[model samples]
Target: MGESTAPILRVNQLNKQFGTGCRQCNEVGSRQLDKNYCTACGTVHACQQISFDLYPGEVLGIVGESGSGKSTLMRCLYFDQEVTNGEAFLTPYKDGSSNLFEESSQQQRYIRNHLMGKVYQNPVMGLRMDFSSIGNIAEKMIAAGNRHVAAMESRGSELLEKVHIPLHRMKEAPKNFSGGMQQRVQIAKAMSNNPPILLLDEVTTGLDLSVQANVLDLIKHLQRELNISIVLVSHDLGVIRMLADRTMVMLDGQIVEQGLTDQILEDPQHAYTQQLVHSML
Candidate 1:
């Protein structure tokens, strides 16, 4: 990722909050709250004024503990949840001139199908458990307007092979596979449409150590081979250290620190970041 290269994805002041705000918590400068929660209004600010750029072929890691809003940020980007207020621009969409949040629902669906692919932390969220593994990949391709059965079948087989899923078992449902295999199937399905941007939300979480290593290796290899931009969200710094070029540390629904992954690991600045680094040590 060259610094001179333009960002494939740019987000500005992205905010996602639940519940209506009261006068006490509505004020911009004077709003006081417990962490990300507004005490007076009973509102939870899941993401607050989040902004970042994802360059082509770059893996940007968002690291935070649970409830720190890292996953929420990913959800907003993938259009799984609507943003309260913000603007996101994609270079492949309208030359980055239009804010994706303002686009109609139909247009947003187009963006989701063609421009972005997301693998959720849970395989169930990303896959149809009852559908065959290859069928899941075909579902995504079909959503992207692929109607040719032979082409979809060929593409699905290639993707399954890319993720190291056995070709013989391509007809099996995800529910019949182990956790690691199911996640791999999800990866294949997500990549089926050849999306430019991939969102991975704790993709390796809840797996055995060996399984986690295998999944991480698959993602690393696939990202390099495809040269796709990735926004990887995880609480594990070890995972970020292994995969991310740059890191953004979020705390209380805000970015506390951000810099090159090596720099942040060596000399963390923010108090929360320092604690995180120290914990890893």
Candidate 2:
């Protein structure tokens, strides 16, 4: 069969509930939980599956209110945390297989180092705060086995310029930069290795509108130029509409709605999704 229309980043019956002990063989009482929800009262579900077909050069937005499991799902897919059950496949167009859900830690490490890139919620989450902005990004490139890694001395200058940072400030600590600039640095770092997939979690949360627009535009520009698949974790509808080709709406740890951006925006199917759409306007 050819590729299914679903998505390259496929989640098959994926479920995650934060609790103690193994997925199977754990006693319910010892595992702390009033319900399926986390102790924080995040929602829980009997069957929470997250799947989408992320063809090269498309962005998928995962949006929902706080405690809606957007971050949980992203972290699960990113391999920062384990899924309760099911699989997440990260298939590349020209690659042999996705295997993001592979059992081998070595295989996971291989993909984490080269096949995937991440932008976490906090600006510094994916960056080395102690390092200069450019060095932060360059270190990732070098670690990815760029034996003769081009002197980031020049490339870093160019990237800072591309992201609208002063080229001369490439050597400045990322901490010296404001929140917005820190976010930009994180973006720069995420793009350094040029992974086929990017997991962006609330990338513009604290940015001003102008900076947010700039960052969003930079992402759009890079997506086109790099032809990378992006999974955006955000609460902003405007950002989602502008950046996503499709959207996944989660509620109570379950996907209430999912489909093409226009479909979900114009005619949301679920009650929760409808509320999200109406609230955006």
**Reference-based lDDT, each prediction:** 0.95, 0.76
Write one digit per residue (lDDT tens) for candidate 1, span 107-194.
Answer: 9999999999999999999999999999999999999999999999999999999999999999999999999999999999999989
User: Which segments of candidate 1 are over 4 A away from where they belong?
Assistant: none
lDDT at 178, model 1: 95
Collision pairs in model 2: 6-53, 7-52, 7-53, 7-54, 8-53, 8-54
| Deviation (Å) of 28 in candidate 1 | 2.6
lDDT of 2 by residue, 1-281 (tens): 13654455666777676544343324433544433454444434323565556666779998888878888887877788777777666655234354456557766666776878888888756888889888887887787766554666666777778788887788899888888888888877877766888999999988889989988999999888878889998888899999999898887666778899889999999998888889888
Name the candidate that leads on lDDT.
Answer: 1
Every model: Cα RMSD to truth: 0.8, 4.3
In angstroms, the error of model 2 at 11 is 2.3
**For candidate 2, which ten residues in a row score worst on lDDT?**
20-29
Q: What ranges in model 2 sit over 4 Å off?
A: 1-7, 20-47, 93-98
